[model samples]
Target: MSRDEQLRRAAYEEMEKHKDVVEKDPYRLHYHLMPTVGLLNDPNGFIQFKGTYHVYYQWMPFKTGHGAKFWGHYSSNDFVNWTHEEIALTPSEWYEKNGCYSGSAIEHDGKIYAYYTGNVKDEEGNRETYQCLAISEESLHFDKRGPVVHLPDGFTAHFRDPKVWEQDGAFFMVVGAQTRELKGAVALFRSDDLENWDYQGVLTGGGEGRLADFGYMFECPDLFPLGERDILIFSPQGIEASGMKYQNVYQAGYVAGQFDSATGTFEHGEFEELDRGFDFYAPQTTLDDKGRRILFAWMSVPDQNEQDHPTIEHKWLHTMTLPRELKLVDGKVRQVPLEEMEDLRVGPAIQVNVELNRETRVLKAVKGKAFEMEITDLSMTEGWFDLTVGDGIRFVYSSGEQTVTLERKSYVNGVVEKRQCSVKQLNSLRVFVDTSSIEVFVNEGEETFTARFYPSPNNDTVRFETSHQAVFTIRKWDLKHVNLK
Candidate 1:
């Protein structure tokens, strides 16, 4: 066998040895694709090709830490149900000897083309990167195309995560880059045959010195046309906490503005954090054949210590959030769960449209780990309302103060705890309740809190109490049972 074949077989053998432990992991989600073992980060090569949605991720199969990265593949017919495919590309080939890092996928004619970043470290341990390509005519078996485009000038080796799309009979790509001066920026390139690329120029850069540096280098830069505006999403590494945003160790956010393909320059405004949570990064977008832009985020962030994760004992490191539909409305983007999730509603959901009486309402007829609730405010003298979801977990939406705060007591069974995000207004609220988590999206994605809770199954009751007379329209849907892959 060739050396590449030997390395592939060895990596596959390592993954096979841990199958039992991976399957027995207790922290696995019911529906999301998780690492059977080791660390999984950065949703790479996300695309819907040949009628199936393919999602590849950064995987290190041997241990629960980031080491010897490879591309792990999973496909879905409905986006809700996923099937694990064979490993797409291991770091066995000469081009990707160190690791095959994050990149996007594209469907050309009838074949699926995967473009990723190849990592190589020389004897001195100096890092070298190449934006590489591989193709799969059958969508399962792949043919390595080798490194199609070498790194252009005026940038450091921090360049990676290529996002490609077709426009006006030509293909375009945006890569996260850092200048020799250590400034964060994104580089744009144009291609016709997907082999040779012409470097355009710096798409965005030099905002507020290195502090607004967000990071010394922006990783996973994604730019796609959304409705009337263009959205550029990236992971900025060195952002400091100025006020409400950028409080996390790292920030995965987007800047909305206009893109000029002719000049390869994007003039965008301030960056907005996509998901205000403990875990969110390297988000990528793909437009379905129908033209709707859908997004998936890396649900695990690099925070605290590797061993501090509660799910470490389970062997896997991370999972992705539910698929969300992105719609640009009135210049801002709004994210809502796809309609396919509605099929998860099992029992008859009870939705009440009523006028408030200033008194608390305690309804014990319904309770579950997976549920969706939509609350619409009709009119209220007092703007504050409390949504109590068992125990001391209270979601306070104060319209008068224009802030929404989520407070939890004994949250996540004392395993994980957090108090994050403040949204404005109480007009409309959607709450997703999971077995050990609660995700609240206020005013249609204006602000979101992806958080965890650990209450007894018996205490899953949802109650509502108000400060004054306020009319409300409540719609509830019990999510379909998920057999988490």
Candidate 2:
């Protein structure tokens, strides 16, 4: 047997030994992709091949920290039901002796081609990166073909996370990079075949003046066309906080702009954050067979609240956000829950209209840890309104101020932390609650807030209160469990 196969089997054996302990962690998500053991980081190599959707993530099966990562695999026919696959890539090659970092997947000439970063360090502790490729015909087992694209000029070893796609008869790859001068940027490359690549140039950098620019180093770059323009999605590190934005140590946002293929430059607009919440980063997308752009993000931010997570005692760490279908409307991307999710709704939705007037709260079968809720036709006279989910999280909106806030009990300092954004008006709200996470879609996806918090699993109460008169209609649906077997 190959050394890669040996490492993969040994990791699976470790997972088997910890299954009972990990399963006992109440924070384990019911319908999200999480590591069987150890840590799960960025969503890597996401694609839909031959009508089967495959999601490969960064996994370290030995502990709950960022270490040598293996690609954990999950497959789904519809986004609603998923089946876990074997470990995809193991750190067994000389170029990737340390780890196989984040990358993307594309189907080329009747085979599934996986492009990723090979992270290795020499004995003297120097870093080296290789833009590598592997191919599989049946999408079951892969044969490593080694590096297809070498490191180009001006960029350091931080250049990784290659997102590949085919456009106009040629393949284009966008990779996160940092120049030797320490400026963060996304570099562009072109290829007629996946084997040979030509570095075009840095598309943009992290200075305040350029398009798609902000941060010390960019990571996980994805560039694709949406609506009438193209969107470059990336996670930028080293951005200082601007009001309620950039609160996390890293930020995952995008620049909506036009890409000139002839000149290999992207002229874009401002950087808008994709999610306004505490626990979202490193998002990736793929166009499904149905022509809809579907996205999945690693549900935890790096170097923030990770140590405070309660799941580490059980030998697991994080999850992926529920699959969201993306649509570009009015020059902004809108994310709606996948329509296939309705397959998991248990019963008829319970609907009611609640009128608030300086009262504490009220509830009637409107609370659950795993359910969906929609509020619409909002009417308010004055003052702010709040809805408390579980014991540690709350959602507040003030129509008088045109602001919405998501507050959580800080795992960092055990105090309240909030992320606030202006919404112009409170048209409606759609919220999804799972075991340890909440995702809110505002105004038909004009804005979104995603968060993960560990409230007492037994406490599933949702309550609403207001300081003045207000009225809103609420519909709640209890979601059925999809066994992750």
Candidate 3:
């Protein structure tokens, strides 16, 4: 048998061995995508081809930890229902022996062409990187086209994650890279026929004065146009915490700018973080047939409390965040949950209009482990407003300070930790609560906070507390588990 076939068979065997344990975990998300077994990270190869939405993720089927990665595939006709397909790429080829790392997908001439990073390491722990290609005629089976672009000069093997797009009838690719000086950068390249690539200069970073002293390495660089501005989203490592921002171990953010294809220059604005949360990283975006920009991110950060996750005992580790539709509003990116997510609402929504004044109220109907809640038409002429869901997960809005804070018990230690973001007004909040996670969209996606919390399984309580007067209309729906075949 071929080595690829052998590896695929082994992965399937591993899934069979641990499927029961993984399924029994109380924390398994109902409406989110997660590995059947083992570890999953970095949403990859996200695209819509021939009217079908395809999402591939970095998967390691043997254990609930990082290792040689494979591309795990899923497809959906509408964004609501998903079908988990067979593994797309395994780490069986020589160049990608270490792993088939993260990348993006594009549809050209009725075929799906995927570009990814081939990660390889020598015996001495040295690294080698290649920009590889895999083409699918029918979007189900991919045939490897091997490496189309090799490591260029002046870069270390820390380079990977090629995000490709078609601009003006030519294909342009942006790769996350680290210079020999060990500075993070995004290198640009051009290809005429999807194979032969010409190296363009650094589109951003690489110690250029364009950006301040940034991180040491950048990974998963995705560049696309939203509205009239081009958006470049990337994950940068080694950014220290500045106030309430960059508090995560790594940062996933974007800079809105204009890209000059001929000059290979990206005139951009300052970096703005995409999500202000503990467990968001490696985000990838795709433009659908409807011309809407959509994104999916790995809900867990790499090397950030991975071992401490309670789900590790059940042999599965991570999940994908709810797919968000991206919009550029007032010169910044706004992420709103996809309209199709409304299809997950199962029963009649419980609606309430309440006013609070220096008191706490628990709405018995607004409680569930897996549900969606929206508090709209909010008028907070109060000192502070707090919403506590389940056990120790709290969302507090300080109208006096014009800030919103999300507090949850730390997984490593039981102490409650908080992540805060500034807001001008406490207008609206849309919260999605799953078995083990909470995602908050504030003010129509003006800001967002996503984190995983392991509340007591029986603690299905939703409480509202306020220091002074606060009024809002709350509507909630219990979201059903997605149909995954």
Best by lDDT: 3
Better of 2 and 3 by lDDT: 3
TM-scores across all candidates? 0.89, 0.98, 0.99
- For candidate 2, report its TM-score: 0.98
Write the residue-wise lDDT of candidate 1 on 244-332 in tens digits: 57766788888899888767667777788887755677888888877778888877567634455556666667777667788887777
Give the per-residue lDDT digits (tens) of candidate 2, residues 40-147.
Answer: 988888888888999999999988988778888999997778888988999899988889999999998889999999999988988999999999897778899998
The lDDT values for all models are: 0.76, 0.88, 0.92
- Cα RMSD, each candidate: 3.2, 1.3, 0.9
Q: Which predicted model would earn the best TM-score?
A: 3
Candidate 2: deviation at residue 250, Å? Answer: 0.5
Question: lDDT score, residue 182, model 1?
Answer: 81
**Which ranges of candidate 1 are over 4 A from the true structure?**
1-26, 122-125, 206-214, 304-306, 352-362, 388-394, 407-424, 452-473
**lDDT string, candidate 3, 1-485, tens digits:** 99999999999999999988888898998989999888999999999988889999999998888878999999998877899999999999999999999999999889989999999999999999999999999877899999999999999999999999998878999999999999999999998999999999888999995664798999999999999899999999999999998998999999999998877789999999999888899999999878889999999888888999999999999999999999999899999999998999998989999989889999988999899999989887759999999886999999889899999999889899988999989788999999999999999899999999998889999999999998899999999987577
Clash totals for all candidate models: 9, 0, 0
- Tell me which of candidates 2 and 3 scores higher on TM-score: 3
Q: Counting only residues 3 or more apart in sequence or on different chains, how many pairs clash (N, Cα, C under 3 Å) in candidate 2?
A: 0
